[model samples]
Target: MNFNREDMNIVIVGHVDHGKSTIIGRLLADTNSLPEGKLEQVKERCRRNSKPFEYAFLLDALKDEQEQGITIDAARCFFKTEKRDYIIIDAPGHIEFLKNMVTGASRAEVALLVIDAEEGIKENSKRHGYLLSMLGIKNVVVLINKMDLVNYDEKVFENITKEYTEFLNKIDVEPKCFIPVSGFFGENIVDPSNKMSWYKGQSVLEVLDSFEKEKLPDDKPFRMPVQAVYKFTRDGDNRRIVAGTIETGRVKVGDEVIFYPSGKKSTVKSIEVFNGEARESIGSGYAAGFTLNEQIYIKRGEMAAISGDIKPKVTNRIKVNLFWLGRSPMVKEKEYILKVGTSKVEVKIEEITKVIDASNLNNEVKQQIDRHEVAECILKTDKPIAFDLSHEIAQTSRFVIVDKYEIAGGGIILKELEDEENKAHKENYKWEKSYITLEERAEKFGQKPALICITGKENTRKKAIARALERKLFSDGRRVYFLGINNTLYAEDHNKKEHIKRLSEVSNIMMDSGSILIATASELNRDDIETMEAAVNSKEVIKVWVGENEISEIDEDLFVSKEDTVELAVDKIKSLLQKKNIIFKPF
Candidate 1:
């Protein structure tokens, strides 16, 4: 069904008991949008049970009680004005139902966040605002609901608006407007209320009508994350259809498409659909599937894009602006599943840059993000996934974190970061072979080549420990070298991230040359360790913590203390090397 006016999907959100359902019921009733006798049937049931009538009852338990405003689920109803038609999504407001709320609001183009004038801004009020921003729903209108409870006072509305507006601004969400309304009394709902003469602006119906329909992003680069590959060969059609909704730009027959992170290319052979006209093209916002000329082994979680236009970035590391809703604190090292469009990746928190309290916009430096806290952090995925930056493509860049089968957090991809696992170094596999192999080199050196990284906080003697071990090995006539921070940073590419990569690369070369390389970096963390390991090999890399490190992210192969004697530290390191078969005991 099509409407002459713009069609919109709007989610009504706020805290529990904040009158979201009441406003939805009032809008449907006021606009005469409900089905025939649906409203009366509900009222009659209420009358039969001798219960008070509630507008919220129309929404929850559609076949059951009318008072069930919240069944802890997101439910949709239809309503329309002369200007536009709406699919009003009633998102659950209870804190336990956050996942349901995200499911409803994630697809909404606009949101109406209700607040109780008497209760003021509550916890979920600020939280929902934060979510809308992260979900890329910038078109929001705040409703200071239940003005009748506060006697339709203008000052009360103004005060609540000021406080809530300030909170939204902290999360970088500027609401479109604030409206005062009593959903129960129908004040400023469909029609402006004479009781609220001071509210001279548009009514709720007017604002709903005035909101510009969310336009499809047809002009941007074409991106459709591969949701599935279908081979319906049994139905006399032998086409493999690659399916997903186009997040941006358009696609036409014969267009050259590239499946990314893999960088494989294919051409669109035909537009496949259940039943439609002989369509030659499709654009963004359509759930389109296409048959490729050549069936490449592409799978879900890889994005399909049009070649020669803008391309999606392929990387395993990204910096995100995220909100945590997990019952447990979002601690580093805990693996979580991140879903962006059709891509699902195993991800771990690499760093917590900053955690912001949504209620007061207070920024704190914390190692973990607790439930309902917002944070800026870096994430390292198990593999690369294709994506555009959040600011560039809102639909494809936003993602949710799933912890234990529940959406524990949601965030937007702010930036792509360089990872040690990038394919740039994969070219080394093409190098010419040497007759004297790694095993021969190890036999000549009398020890297996390994990269030992000593990491600790500043003034913790990490470098001292690394130098001591290198000296002990050198004294024993073993091939060993120590590279400190200044050794790697003495030249160009001295940034923290680049330095880590360079250190790992240099260590890999030295190890290949039959010399054990001991490196020391005070700023090293788990991501750096992973990068170092990826550069060389995990089994060939040994991590030793020199002092107190609070994070549980990295599992060190060995631990030393500042109080341990240098000779004792060296002895312990040699013992571990022997245990790992990196070295053999000598007479």
Candidate 2:
């Protein structure tokens, strides 16, 4: 199998009943690309059914599609031109199968957005245009199809051209050319149309032949996300291969490669290929594997990049421009899976900054994102994932959100959030404790070591309640200590966050001695609790709140009124501790 010409993937997209399939059928018929009896077989079936043979019906092989007269899924047709071989992908134009259209368009290098000249621009016409821009397709050619319905009027062509151009321009897209044609009559498709004598431009075939090949990212920084790590030690051959498709640039043998997030470094020992000649290097668009010189601890989710100045950003939080296609609205509370490159992580919508309607580009202020709505939001993943900015490196930046194992949304990273990881909080610091195990100490003390947090608004008697709880627990023969705010923590530490951190650290020290540490804080939200949780270095913090229900983000184990007596609050805390087996029951 030898090929002299390059392969060009061209996708035809538009609204329903706009003659997209008809145009494709016509292109096949005129170019002599169809199989010997493909057209005749379709025509014979139509004749047997006592139906008229239409160009649109030629591509609709399914009985349902034949009856409905619309394309349901993306259909591929292979044909060759003098310059190159083309794979014409006919994408469905209906709104219901937008995902199918996206799948088709994402694979194409060139697009032909078809429109009905008589019907003019419709809702999907604008939506598909917006999607094309978002899908990163730069080479677009608009076809004002069905000119015969409009009596081949040049004015009709001009009007659609003017209207669609304005819409496309708003989204920063400038089409390469707009051609007037009738797919049914084969006007300006394969041959120059005599009906529209006033128009002079390249025909459909000419424009397609003139289309340039998609540029590979060979000159960019080398980045290959590790898709899988294979160890085929079954045949006494021990070669741990890191497999992935090169997203950009090239990777050669002996190139120093660095894995992100974990910051593991290794050198490429060899380029591994199956049943292929020995290759020195593999460039972008090649799914190649590498055998590292050193067996460093590398994972599938990490990206392999050439160690240099150009590198992907390592962050857990990111700001993105995303489109929601899920049946349910994208809310901040729910967790979704975000897949970028080869990395997949559990993510949540941290914040919704803005929402825009794809049809009209209207800005909407909403907390939740509904289906087909585009939103700018901050998404936080459970762990750090490496990626590039959309504008800087598109291949590594674009991602998709999966809800319930289905791809529900797609997004591009706009900015990386660095503040989340900026607070080191003594990364290398470890607590110095007595040789005796904390669990052993707890057993000896007849109580479990726990950090009991009593939180509420200011002047809610939280400190008094904490002190009472400590006294009650101590009287019950359990070693407990009370740590109040506004004493040594907040006053000595100028920063409020630092004060809360110090309080947590001090509470941890008390718990290390198998003592129940009662601490009082004001207005603790989820993030604050997380900070304390991290500082304490344990999941022993039992949350209890006083006063009105002000914090909705966190679920407290118990809520007590500020008017409650300190003794009653202490009794309630004791009962909760007993229920969790944190304290021993009296015999």
Candidate 3:
């Protein structure tokens, strides 16, 4: 039994007061991993307080935790068997601390789901089971703790095991085995229990050694998000190197790579290191840098991937399965920052498809995702981002939402949604440089040029609102124009794409002249918006939906109800324009 093998991470999770900490404490004390006199110190403290000593006090070192008698944080402990070393992560069972539990369990390969035999299956028991599967922990073992209270009855253990297995099966989680254990008395943990002769199975220590270590993803598609681009000219050792830690697969010198979201192509020139020997190749889990053959201008947040491998999806919209743990409910019409890999971008909840109750597995159709609720939603980013689907590469598919500078939620990307702007036929045409920069034009006009698309259903008051907005802006001493989509000049043919292209060309001219171009196109889909954005280089396109029911799948910036009068709609659009800085606010 070689104990020098790779270490395995295992998380212990269950409901509050279900003996999670007790199990960890017993495992540590039994393995002789505790420091000298540490156990005596805790026992003396318990005696001073006139309380009996328990095994749970060994890991709950926090004063608050000792007084409250519940784990507030994810505590960690280490122990070793003859086969391999184990890092046991003790996650909290309180519902308020589910976010901390998720953070800890995400780093583990196996999960230990404990259930109170005397309390039967509780709410957190089911919730923890589902989360274990969602976190990609495939190997799970059921620990029926506190069997002493149940008189070590085999029937009590079997009934709880049957109920939990059914729940796990619904979530596609199959437990490896169910072991009845008394962590308080250390039965079925390290030594066999003489009380239960009918049960003949491996101990908890034996099961830990049976689980295999998860293999590193060195054979998958290569993925490395560019962290920084360094150029050190101080010592005359000028090497334009792109540096990042590889998330998966391996890379070698001379390999053709493509930077995502920009589609820039380059070949790896040379592997780089500081104060070390030269290398020709590098694998995952190592921070490395390499120069490129072409001088491509790629900034941070761009994913550097091998060309021949499965290319990452680039889009502004995605469908994800996420859990909300924010102080406020995740609602529509508000923006949040989504961080995935090294890329952070402004994201908004476009639509909430379903909100799931993790404990009962019940789903409801709602517009907002409340705290502690799991939801499947469509999120649209302000710009395009590069990512892989969770099924393809789980490492790069995970992301977190930052609200008010705090990580309020986390999730995995389920599917990539095609954005019309990103799906447009990409060409290698170079833009003709203008003599004056955009800053010069913006300063001269006292406002930034923009393309305002007033879109909604056919019967909605889109054209009326568009004309009213243009009239108000013009009266306010600003250059503005109202163009109808069905203008006879470009509406001659029925080709919608060609018609949109021509309209976009006209709008581009108006925007270039520093005028706010308001175009009314009814039932405009995402593809139409993409075409218009591609034509107007670098200008912001604000889609204002002028109806209650948004039939088209356009990611609109503002929504004005059709019940509002033309004056109110115009005011709403004006306020939005001011907020977006399309027009200067009055001092």
Candidate 4:
């Protein structure tokens, strides 16, 4: 049967042996949703095996599940009510398969948590409840199954409801309703049950139909994690396209867009389609592609968002609520891989704020996160990544952790933290401002402010060229200054890296006064240049290498040979600055 986008995803989760599969099978059978004669085929197979037929057998398609009487993976079954269609995900309830459970539940818009009335609340039941909360599923219905075994006792149902309700509340989950069901007897599943008149509520089918379809995030800001950047040179057609499924809102041709983590800006030139008429705009859920007005360096991992909307946070440090499922416990200072959206980066647990006992709501201070334990912790990535908070946009907020190339944990970002690099930028922005703005200063000085970094190996005459350039510019009625790296050497407990950082900050401050600040540092590699670029205006940082050989992978604006005298080298550098418009050339 064809299903539309309004179809809802509902996940069934509970402890092992909690009749989760049985409930789904009964729902399908009672509603006449099973395939033609598939029910009879299963029944006949049971008879041939000399076994009594169970509703759970209809869904236990795998031989291992039938043998062990437990699900090992998430199974999807489609059913329809008159209101809308549903994709019921039967998530495995075994604790060992909790990761599988997460995978299933993550796709669901609503959840139905099952608990065996005879067995009462199991550890897995509460654990699943906590996971439902963490997974951002707000709509939940608790199903107390096997009420027939308890003789449909109202007292037993009420007691289980009260206890589980209290437990769910601790995790900030308020279940929509509590249902007592007997999949074996088909009571209160599709039809009202005469066996229990004490209960007054809709049946499972009615409850499901009552649920409104989860509204698409079309009203939010446009966000699309670039899945791929395609270049089709076939038949001499040259078009660089950015392609991905929109996670929220819409994008149209001519809209200004910005990519985060790199902060590149561009305009949507045209929308591309396959064998269809070109569209003017596209919204969430469309796997779309577009050409840009300008060629900017955008990779697969960056978030392309509308420039005017709420921007996604870009940072290397973040706080998260995560659960561990690895064989080895998650320890502090150990490296792992964090995958969010299309971006995957090396990550590490900075600190475990606390480990939570999901079954009982107990908190403990721990150095490591054990299997099946939930925790709130700080995570540090090797580089900046773009994402939203869980409260803001959950689609971009969710992440998974891979340990040893295997998925070991999943979580949502609580918030982004200000790392040292970000803090430095923030501090730089708050520096004292003069009444004369930088623009005014630039107009008076007739030169745009810039940081010219002269870098090369030790004993390469970098300082001499920097000083000579400063002298020439000052003599030519220009604002210029030369600072050496060693000036900040003895500043209170600063290391080599910290010294470089200080030099960058000073350059930033000096550049704010509309002066061409020329600085020299020995053996400056790509990283050092990047650090200085981050602290100052990246576009204004002109890198000049004064050596015979290249050291690292640095993008140098000018390369001077050791044989070239300092004066000619200075003249070449000056000509470059004039070409770049950093300084005005003589008329």
Candidate 5:
């Protein structure tokens, strides 16, 4: 088979001590890709440690790795078969290093799952396979290594291969090729082995060389997520270039494109690459900058796609399938930072709809998602961010969740909720009244004053203040709706953005009802505080500061002591309510 110089990235993955590194080392050595004198240095180091020379040492060249005899980090090694060049990523097999494994596997186009013939399919081996599938890696080649330890027995290889194939079937990963080889003995790797005459399959190198590289799709709609904007002054020429890798499809010199989330439109003036102008059109897998005919506003992470093909939607609510890797349990009502593509937005878990059992891919009904558990949960962001479904667009659909500067989870967007009525309903308030509607009561009571309570931490104090103020206002016969800071049931779970959006919705409800809106929340940031202030009825919102320090932004001396109980505070607030000329009868 003829091979072209296409870029093929392969990841070596399996359980620990499954001869993955050994196979890679042998592949590099047999292909003459190792640097001169590097092999001799490894050999000397092995001898100094009183250890026999191992092929795996060639790849695990790190000193720490040599001491521990375990690969702690993913290592990338470059080599070439006679047909094509390859960048081989050796992923760690330990379960503790699963994050590192994901880091490596994310860059690979194909995976090489190594299995020991004697041990058959193991825990990490199956796990790596399952993760690869989740990452959308469809190309896999299974290698049954350590055949020499089994006396190169064909029956042993066949039995293990059959068992592994069954396990892979359960996970829905059909390997393109399964080869039996001994990396230590240098058999069935670079060349065919005569010892295993029962096996007539191609060698490892031959199979890899023969595998067809999937071509980038060119017929789909053009999508270029703007990564950067460049203004270059060279040789007295001023040029503005919008640069990013083409995520999918193709674009030409005169195609009309739109910058999303902003809805700005422009026509492409020219496509520029580093090596000068190209004669043909550029498609996916190429990073090129384009100059637009009209100077329009475009920023990083903004998607530019062919106009009228597929419009990007800005949504606040999204459903995602998450894989948690955090130390603490993913609790409801907490907020976390979500980084998707180039946007970092505040997000909250709305609900733990269901937890997924990774072992069998079954949904487990639970309230919390613990570490190492996969779940289908709903996430709501503070603002609308452009995204596509995982099946529709994998590049823009994936995201990572960070809490306290560490990546706690990663997930893919499953579905984007787009019903405007449902969106409004999710953010609306439903209240039961006694005598009159809130608007009529406020109009009748001669403008009942409103109270806005703000705090800086999530604690019982926030809720306690709200309840106390509500009771006092009720006693004074004022129309009031005490909006608590509980957002756990809003969006399938308590997502931070959803919670904040819920707060915004409550503010709107207060404005529409024309009632005294009293909101209590902990750690309300400057922006959220401003949003709440803007949404309340200006004629009635009585701003109440209920914490230690005074919020200097809002010009009001409504500071209430944090130590006061709700009843005592209500008495003090009642006098203030009377002085403001606000009166209503208790219902």
Candidate 6:
């Protein structure tokens, strides 16, 4: 679609009741961009609801929102000024409507942060500002709205502006312009206000029109996040096309391009837009399709860009700053659905390095992130996905975490998985040596107690103890199998079996190995523990309880303790081995 000479995409955002919708409505009415009967229809609806005719009602269309007298979703309104055509997105200011704000702001190049002159900077106002920074929106114009409510007082405007400026400075966002206006009174929005003659500044529209679009980074590498794939069969042509809006740089025909993660390379055959193939090259801001010379597997959501200058990395773990909005607390064990651009994958919160106290933005690592809290966390996905740092590339860096089908949090990746191959190799080697040495010793000793399951209330503490025990057992020249719950072998093929059968299988494997299996299970009920005990056979089983819970009424000696150290637990197990008369040479 062709735009006017000064066409720009601008999003209006602020706290709810900050007059975002009214500003848009007044701009449309003043510019004569409203459709013929649209205003009349809005008026009729307002009357039926016993509400005063609000210009905001012209844009907010959701029935629930209109009934509640609040905007719950982002509303898009297109209008034109004498100078430029604008696609103005009116985003909700309510804190719960943050995801809607992100959706709207992600599309716009410029943002108008509307703050109330009467209320100053509220929570949602600061939150919107922080989110804008996270989204990489630098071109911001802070509108100090409700000048009429503040009696168009210059002092009120100045005070609020000063306070907001301080807050913005703390967050590293410097507003390009600060304009005082009244959306309800239609003052200083489309035209200059005579009442604010002391404030010799340009009108809102004038400032927007005068503001220059931030220059594209000259040093930025080519990045195209694949949005969709097109297969055109028009009479004769049967071509496969990959299409997306370029996030940065430029790509030309015959440029060597690479698909991420898969690392498949191909030459760009042609750059095709809606108006057929373009003779020149296509740059950022244009949605275009490219046909590759060879058929390489390029899927939707995969990034395709110039190969040599920049390459996307496949990473399993990432350190990111997350804003948790889920009703449920974000726990480490539970998995969350993550979406970066079009790529979606299930990821677990591996480690919450720090939970930022949103009230003061303090780093609190040990504290659990509750609803509406922002946290710096480490996440590990089930598979390797392409990613970049937010500072390096905003498009690939930002992501949203979803829980129970609702967007819970949004974040930016701070660091990608580093030294992953080396870590993987070390882990593999450890597991291999443990398994090999245990099997060899088992064969020699004729299948002794190979597995030692450590029952506990906390899985993390249990794993830590299990690791320490593995070292101790291996040093004592005994085969030790330290099986973590995350083991893929046990996770797979356990779906079809009954609950009892699954436990039995795990126990049978531990026994067959003839090596002590030190593992932990959380929330182990009496029945489950009994099933596990029976599976391993009471004669060969040694139970270590971490909490005050009776194992079973069976004939097996149990060691129960509330001690929190791994060393103490290891000593108890060592004493038990001595009591059993299992003699072995220490390494």
Superposed on all Cα atoms, the candidates' RMSDs to the truth, in angstroms, are 14.3, 13.6, 14.3, 6.5, 11.6, 15.6
lDDT of 4 by residue, 1-587 (tens): 44453578888889888898888888777877666686898899999999999988877653444477653322333566666667775456433233443422236778899999999999989888988898778889999999999999999999999999888888899999999999898999987789999999988888888888878789998999888888878999889899887888999999999988778799999998766777899998777889999876577788999988999999899999998878899998889999888888899989899999877879999999998899999999977899999899888888888898888888889999988765767578686777898788878989999999898888888989999999999998899988888886885765767887889888888887888988888767655765787788789999899887643345578888899899999999999999999998979
> Native-vs-model 5 lDDT?
0.71
Q: What TM-score should be assigned to candidate 5? A: 0.67
Cα lDDT of model 6 by residue, 1-587, tens digit: 23335567787888778788888878777776766666788888888999998777666643444578653322223676666677765355333344544422345678898988887888777777777776777789999998988789999988888888887788788888899898888888888998888788888888888867656543478877788877777998878788987777888888999866545689998888887756458887667888888865456667776878867666778998877777888987888888876677789987888876553556666646787578888898755577678888776677788889988888788898753633543343243333455447556863366345566566436677778878987876776777654552344455422454354456556555665666555544433443454355545666566655533222224454665567887777776766764434233
2 versus 4: better TM-score goes to: 4
| Candidate 1 lDDT (Cα, 0 to 1) | 0.80
lDDT of 2 by residue, 1-587 (tens): 02556878877888888989899888877887766677798899999999988878766663345377754222333566677777765457333233443322245688899999999998778877877787677889999999999888989999999988999999998899999999998988888988899999989999898878988999999988888888777879888889988888998998999988656688988898867765889999887798989876566778888988498998888999987888888998899998888788899988899998887889878999988788999999976789989898877887888899888888678999963543343341454658999779877998888888888778888888888787777778888888865563644457766677677767767777788888787887654675676656545788899998643334577888777788888888899998888997777
Better of 1 and 6 by lDDT: 1
Model 2, 554: alpha-carbon shift in Å?
32
Q: Which ranges in model 5 have alpha carbons more than 4 Å from their true place? A: 1-4, 62-77, 93-106, 233-238, 278-280, 360-362, 419-422, 425-587
Candidate 3 local lDDT, 434-490, one digit each (tens): 677667888987888899889887788888788888888988888888888777244
TM for candidate 4 is 0.77
> Which candidate, 4 or 6, has the higher lDDT?
4
lDDT of 1 by residue, 477-519 (tens): 8898999867777565657877887787788777778788888
What do the candidate models score in CA lDDT, each in turn? Answer: 0.80, 0.79, 0.80, 0.83, 0.71, 0.70
lDDT of 6 at 458: 64
lDDT of 1 at 539: 79
Model 5 Cα displacement at 371 (Å)? Answer: 3.2
Candidate 2 clashing pairs, residues 3+ apart or interchain: none
Alpha-carbon deviation at 364 in model 6, angstroms: 2.2
Better of 1 and 5 by TM-score: 1
